[model samples]
Target: MKTIAIYGDSISTGTHGEGGYEAMLKSSLSLERVYNFAVGSSGLTRKTPVGMLEVLDKNPVPKDAELFLIWHGSNDWYWGSGMEEFSHGVKEAVDRLRAAAPTAELVWVTPIYRFECPDGMAQAGEAYELPNKNGYTMLDYYEELEHSSKRLGFPLIDMRRLCGIHRDNANLYLEDRVHPNRAGYQRIGAVLDREIQRFCIY
Candidate 1:
């Protein structure tokens, strides 16, 4: 059986008051082995809650795993990482994973756009703010990584575009404005399934 590994942040952990897509994808695509190595509030940057060494030491990639799904950058982007720093972190992670799993394909999932908090939850956004914070939108960061993926020759999954397409159709997320609800996770899993089938299949 083929195997897939996920390395990412809170969204990957499904910590924003919602279940993650990892479990769903594992169940739906039972043919592929799945390992989720995600931490809450993580970032691509070494400064964040998790870094390459931590992920590697904690969750050693299984030799049989055929694909590595990298879904980081939310915390890094919000906490403050310019294109140069962001690209470096991502490249470093890619290099590490490549070294560990020489034959595995890498799939990079771009960060999603941030939504305006509902009036009641606006203050909540402020409490979680990071240092050197900028007012630039999340789309800016997503685009930066998207460009990097193009240059790096990795398959990029644009969650920002997916969210935009589905934003009007349903309650895609929770009130936290960060975590996606069950429906949202399902949506993500569907997209991942298609991408994995198209590109990562052995």
Candidate 2:
């Protein structure tokens, strides 16, 4: 029973703020509380008005929060923010979270594979092959996440690599290649549960 705080974009908001993996995790475990600070179209970059920094600024982290799940960054890739700006935003967000929740452990969940196809099985395109307007692929954004996790000294739950949701099986997990439907959310919830619970071992 941990009081977890979640931060992310539309996926974290979860079908009108009550339908994503956060809900699945809460219901499945019957956890006491979950503070969702996610907003639609949010990202680590400052380009978006509802960016992580903005959300953090608006919602102060509770002192009693035990775990902070900083799940974000997809919109940055989709909106075509450069890697350097994205990385800077991540660092700033992490620093602010650390300042707000000194005792809470932080986890970074990287963005998963995405295609434009919505609500169905993916076609033949790979996520990495599709670049945004700036010609930077989702892989670029994901790599930045890896670097930030290591540099910031936090665990990274790399969905792109580990979530089992990819071009081949996205139909089962994602709603629009961008957000997870019920099944997709559950899949992510299970992965998150397994990953975060490992922290209790020590």
Best by TM-score: 2
- Per-residue CA lDDT of model 1 for 66-143, tens digit only, reads 888888767665555565777777777777788888888888887764444322232323212322354434555576
Cα lDDT tens digits for candidate 2, 1-202: 5588888888888673237787677776567799888888777777765788877777777777778888887777666677888889889888888888787888898888777521122332455776666667778888888888889988888777767888788777777676787777767888888888775331
Once superposed on the true structure, which residue ranges of model 2 sit more than 4 Å away at CA?
Answer: 16-18, 27-30, 117-126, 200-202
Clashing pairs in 1: none
RMSD each, Å: 4.4, 3.9
Model 1 lDDT, full chain set: 0.67
After superposition, candidate 1 runs with Cα above 4 Å error: 16-18, 57-59, 116-136, 163-172
Give the number of the best model, judged by lDDT: 2
lDDT of each: 0.67, 0.76
Global local distance difference test of model 2: 0.76
Candidate 2 lowest-lDDT run of ten: 117-126
